[model samples]
Target: MSNRVDELEGQVAELRAAVNGLTEELVETKDRLRKLEAEAASEAEPPAERETKSDDHVVVVEQEQDDVDVATDSLGSDTASEAEPGEAAVEPEETTENDTNKSTDDIIVA
Candidate 1:
């Protein structure tokens, strides 16, 4: 029948439109991936083009490290002087065998 033939043609047209939409999305995604790869390549520095710090830079770093060590040593002595004479460090009480047996003997849930 002509009616059935026309219905089939309409379905075919919808399938073609769907395929075209998906094809366009695939092309755009591929283009975006290529651009990202190119950008990453440009940002990378090759080994031959790498720069090194001079002797002055090394000396400056050593002086900074010495300053840090002196500051930490001063801080350590301050903490040692701050401990109170009355406050002793508390240690946990040692568990007895009877106490362990009593605890594990019963479990109460409320």
Candidate 2:
């Protein structure tokens, strides 16, 4: 019974070591694969085939405004929820974009 227990423990240790080595190899393989894929993608596309956009162009992604507020709240604000007795409440900036250039005729692909 004692010999059987010792043999089982040794097998377990060997199995664990093998798993660790395989995990490390798997991680290395994934890293290599990503690098190869990125290189292949770059090589496949020619410079002239890519569409370039102007730096001044602003991409306005239309989505639910409520989700934006929730995301911002989750990230937290610079101001403390309740300031020290003597400290003043820090007001966040509220700059609104002028819709002078905004248009409904927007195309994602264009």
Give candidate 1's error at residue 100 in angstroms: 74
RMSD of 1: 14.7
What lDDT score belongs to each candidate, Candidate 1 first? 0.84, 0.73
What TM-score number comes out for model 2? Answer: 0.41
Best by TM-score: 2
Residue 53 in candidate 1, Cα distance off native in Å: 35
- RMSD value for candidate 2: 21.2
Candidate 1: which pairs clash?
none
Candidate 1 residue 39 C-alpha distance from true site, Å: 0.8
Where in model 1 is the C-alpha error above 4 Å?
47-110
| Residue 14 error, candidate 1, Å | 0.3
Q: TM-scores, in order shown?
A: 0.39, 0.41
lDDT for 91 (candidate 2):
100
